[model samples]
Target: MLRVHSENELQLNADVLVIGGGPAAAWAAWAAASQGVKVIVVDKGFLGTSGAAAASGNGIMAPTPENWDKVLSERYCLGKNLANLRWLERVIEKTWLSLPLVEDWGYRFPKENGESVRQSYYGLEYMRVLRKTLLRLGVQILDQSPALELLLADDGSVAGARGVQRQKHCTYTVRASAVVMANGGCAFLSKALGCNTNTGDGLLMAVEAGGELSSMEASNHYAISTAFNATVTRGVPFGWASYTDEAGNDLGGYINGRRDPSFLPNALLKGSVYARLDRATPEVKAVIERSHFIAFLPYKKAGIDPYTERVPVTLVLEGTVRGTGGIRIVNDSCATKVPGLYAAGDAASREFLSGLASGGGGPNAAWAISTGQWAGVGAAAFAKSLGASAHERVVYPVGQAGLRSQSNTVETFDSEEIVRGVQAQMFPLEKNYWRCEQGLLDSLASLETLWQQVQANPKQDTVSDVEFSRRAAALTAVARWAYFSALHRTETRSEHIRVDYPETDPNQRYYQATGGLDKLWVRRDWIKDAMSGDKPQNVKVVTGAIDISGKDVGAQGIAPLPRLSGHAQLISGDV
Candidate 1:
C-alpha cells in the first residue's frame, strides 16, 4: 500500500539538514546547532551504529607528552608532502582542542600513568565522543529516517532534503537553508553503487545541484585479517608481521618488513617487526624460520585478544594508507568548489590521508571529528548569510503516477549472497595487494552486469523504498565511474595496481589512478569560468596529471613501486 502526504502535511524548517548519522554526521549536526542554528539530522540507523567508523571503531591521534611532534611529522610525510600544509596544520590544531569537548560531553579515552592521559588511539572512544557531543548540543535527531533527495532552489543551490520515516511510513520534507552530506562512502552498497560501498551520493547530489566531486577513483585498501575470509575485519599493523614464501622460508624478517622503503618512501616505521624482516640476512631468515612469528600472536600483551584465533592472518605486502583518490576541496574552510555544499571525513580530500598514526593505530578519529565541525560551522555560517528567503520548496510528482514499482523491494536483494560474490571476486582481483588491468576490467564487467540486473528490477513504493532504489542507482554510477577510471589509468600507484602495467610509469606517476581524478580535471572549467566571468566551462580531456608539484615525482622514483604477482587472479571471472 502506498501513502501520500499533501504539501500541507510537511513539518519543520531548519537552518541545516544533515544526512547520515555517523560520527561525521554527529559532529556536523552538533557544530551547526551549537552555532545557534536549528538543525535536523536524519539517519538510516540508530545512533552509534552503522557507518565505517562505528563498525570498525574510532580513535583519536593527538599530540601527547609522549611523541607529539613525531606523530605530526609522520602524518604530514605520509601525505607524500602533497597535502595542503595550512589545512593539515589546522586539523592538527583542532584535534587537540576538540578532545576536551568530547570528554566533557561524555566520552573517555584510555589513560596512561594515571595523568589524564594525553594520547590514546581507539575508535570506540571517538564514536562515543561524537554521540555525547551531538546529544548535549540539543540537536534534533530523526534516527531511522534516510534522506531521499536534495531539495534544490531556483538558483540551483541546495535548499534542503526530503526524507521518509521508514518505521512510520510517513513522508517529511525538512526545509533548510543549507545541507551537509556527512554520509559515509558507498563501500557496503557495492551492488547498488557498482564499486565499493562509497556510492558518491553526497558528491553526486552536490554535482547534480552544480557541486563538484574529486578523487572518486581512489580507495584505501588496508591490511586486514585474511585468515577467516580475507575480509578487512581487523587492522594489521605493518610492524607487527612479515610474509614468508609458501615453503615456510622467511622472505623477509619482521623488523625489516615495516613497509618496503621503496614502495612507501614517506612511511615511518618504529618498533616495526617488518623492519627486522627487511634487514634479515640469510642467518636472520634461518633464525626467523625457526621462531614463531610474533605478529601471529594475539594482542593479549596489549590487553586485546589475539587476532589469529579470532580472525585470520596474512603477511603485510605494503604499508596501509588511506584510499588513493579523495574528493577535492580547494578552499581553506572545507568548502567544495560549490557554494552551498560542504564535505568532511573520508569523503573530502585536500591531501590528508585518513589512517596514519604511531604503531599502526587506525585513522585519527579526532581529525575527522574536528574537520566535520569545521565543515558544519562553515556551512551554517554560509546558510545564515543566505537568510530564510533562500529556503526553497522542492515539488515532486505526488500523484498516483509517482507511485513506486514493486520490483525494487529490499526483499529481492540477497545482500549476503551478493556480498559473498563480490568479496570472492574483489578479494582476489581488486583487493589483492597488486591488481592487473585484465582482472580489474573483468571485475568491472561482471559487477556491471550484475548491477544491471538489479536495476532492471528496481523496487519501489513510497519515498523510503524509492530512496533505496536511488542509493542503488547512485552506487551503479559510482562503480561505473571507478571502473571507467581504472580502465584509463595504465600505471601502478598506491593501492591501485595494474598487472599488465606492473611497473609504475614515470610519465603517469603524478596522475591519480581513479576515475574521480578525471572529475578534478573537468572541475577546472568551473574555476576558469569563475575567473573569466563566463558561463560555466566544460573542459574534458582524457588524460592529464593533477599538478600537485610541477615536477613529476615519478621521474625521480619518489612514488611507491607496484608489487604484483603474489596474489591469485579472479576466479573464472564469475563474480
Candidate 2:
C-alpha cells in the first residue's frame, strides 16, 4: 500500500529526463535533484508502484565484505574469463553508501535492537520508501506518460524523448540537456510479474538512438512458475522452499541442494514443479512469512494451506530482469558512446556480465541502485560542463499531428494481437527455456513478421491510435532484439541453454553480441585476452539502412531501425 502520486503536468525544459518510474529511475531523479538540477521522471504507469520495482519477494544485496567476495567469485565462474569485474566492484562500494541515504529518507531495512536484518529481497516497502524520497525532494514525476521514442540532436546525442499521455490523446516532448534511460527490464513477453510498462522501452530507445546492448541472450525465461498460469504472489521462486514434481520427487537434488536459476528451469521437463513450505521449521517459516507475506495471499484465496498442499508453478519470461541484460553503457560514468545519452540498472548492468550469463537477484538489485546514482551524478556533471550550451533542446517542433485529442476513429493495428503474439511465441516449449538454432531462427522469423506488420499497417488518423501504433512498434522491436541476439550466440551457458550447442566451448569463450538489432554483431573473441587497446573483430554483420534520425513527432514510422553503424564498440573497460 504505497501512496502513488496522481498524474502530473507535462514538465518541460528539464536538466535531466529519466524515462522510468522504478527504483533505478527514482534513484537517478533523487541524485539529479539533489544537485539543484531540474529533473522530470515519466512512466507508463504510476510513480511508486509501477514495474517490478514494487513487486514482492526481493531483498537488498548488502555489500558485506565476505558475501561480496563469495558472490563475485561465483558470478565470475559463471562469466568465465569475460566478466566485467570493475563495474561490479563499484556496485559493491556504492550500495552501502546508498542504504544510509535510503534510511535518512525514512526507509528502513529490517532490524532488531540496533542490528541490521538480512532479507532475501526487499518487498513493497522498498518501493514506497523510494517514492516518498523522490516526492520529498521535490522531484517532478509524469506518471502514465509512455515514452514512444528518443529525440536525437543534430550531433546524434539524445536531446529528449517523446511519448503519449494516457487519458489525453496527446503526444508531448520534454526537452533536456541530458537523458537518463532507467526503465526497468522488458517483461510480459512471457507470463511473468513485471509491470506491463517494462516492454523494453529503455533498451529499444537506446539502441535506436545508437546505443549498444549486450546479454540479449540472457533475455530468456526467468523465475518461471512450475505450475503454468497459476498466479504466485512473488514472481521469483524463493530459494529456501522445497521444489518437487507432481510425483513428489526432490528437484533440488539435481542442483546440489541449492537454489539454481538454470537447473531449476531445466527440471521443469519433469512433471509440473511445485514448492512447499509445510516441512520447514517454525523459525524458517517466520522468515519466509516476513519477506514474502504477499505470496501467502494467493494460496489463501485458492482455499489451500501452504502448511499442507504444495503450490504449482511455471516459468515467467522476463528477459531483462531474469536474463540480467540490457542497454550497454560503455563508460564507468554510465554514458554510452552516444555522448549525452546514459543508461543504468538492468538496462546497463548486463554489460558487466557476459552475454552467456547473469548475476543473481541480490547483485541485480544492488546494481540498479548503484548505477542509478552513478548515471544521475555523472549526467549532472556532464550537463554542468555544457555551461552556456546546456540549454534545453526541444525535439518536437510546434504542432505535431497527435497533439490534438480526436474522437471516433477506426483502429488500424490490433495492439493486443501484437502483444499476445510475442508472449505466446517467446515462451513456447521449443524456444523459451529450451532452444536450438532452428527454433531460434523460427522465433526470429516470426518476430520479423510482426515488425513487417508494424510497418505495413497504416496508422489511424486519431490520437489514441497514433499512440497505440508507436507502442506496438516499440514492443515488436523489443522482441526482435531478444530473438536476434539469442540466435546469434552459438554456445550454451548459464540460463541461455541451447540444445544444439549443449556445452560451453572454450573457442567461443567471451564473444558477446552487441550493436543495433538492425545490423547485429558479435565480438570476435573473449575480451579477457585482448591487450590494453586492441580492437575487436566483427564476427557477423548484417547491414540494413537504419533511418531513425528524425527530431519531429512524425518520425514514429516503423522502419527497420537504421542499420547500426557496424562500428559501435562492444565490451571494453572493467573486465
The candidate that achieves the highest TM-score relative to the unseen native structure: 2
* Model 2 lDDT tens row, 50-127: 767576667666657767877666665666545656655677778866777776766666678986654344546677
Give RMSD to native, each candidate: 10.1, 7.9
Q: Write the per-residue lDDT of candidate 1 for residues 217-253, one digit (tens) a residue.
A: 4442444344333334334243344444334444443
Say which candidate scores most in lDDT.
2
Model 2 lowest lDDT segment of ten: 544-553
Q: lDDT (CA) for every model shown?
A: 0.50, 0.64
